[model samples]
Target: MIVIYGIKQQLTPIKAELSDVIHQCMQEVLGFPEDKRAHRFIPMEKEDFYYPGGRSEAYTVIEINMMAGRKVETQKKLIYTLFERIEEKIGILPIDIEITIKEQQSYQWGFRGMTGDEVNDLKYKVNV
Candidate 1:
């Protein structure tokens, strides 16, 4: 799952485009399937969303949660790909985008009434 946070005005209008670019980066870098897109957007008010210096109202934080298995190089590639693709396709510069990947053991994830490790029918590989 991917969670995106940004100021309401600067984020809402581009959610669809951002989601598509993100999913495309995921597919290109991690070999994720098209059907695996899961993005959640949180558009907050200006006062509610506080950001660091040098970033504009367009600053976005993207948090990616997934099962732990991918190699470090693969993860870095995903991050770089997202930064490049988002800037090129969605007009969000790398400096204004913050991305983090949080990975956990497969057993820690529960879906489809079963734990991730027990669900053997996944269409995509996690250990890329």
Candidate 2:
């Protein structure tokens, strides 16, 4: 799953493009399927969305959650791919975007009404 946060005016209009870019990056770097897209956009007010200096209102934060086991190189590739694709395809500068990947043990995840470890049928491998 991916969670995106940005100011409403700058973020709402590009939700579709952002989701496409994110899923595309995931497919390329993470080997995810085209149909496996889970994205959440949180559009906040200007006053609510505080950002760091030197960045415009375009500043966005993306948080990706997944099961652990991917190599460091793979994770780095995902980040770089997202930055490049988002900037080129969504018109969001890499400098104005922040991305973080949060990984947890498979056993800790619950899906399909079962714990990750108990749910054995998965379309993709987690240990990439």
- Per-residue CA lDDT of candidate 1, range 57-101, in tens? 899999999999999999999999999999999888999999999
Give one digit per residue, the lDDT tens place, for model 2 in 9-46.
Answer: 99999999889889988888888988789899999999
TM-score of 1: 0.98
How do the predictions measure up, each by TM-score?
0.98, 0.97
Candidate 2 ranges beyond 4 A from true positions: none
Check candidate 2 and list the clashing pairs: none
The local lDDT score (0 to 100) that residue 91 gets in candidate 1 is 86
Number of clashes found in candidate 2: 0
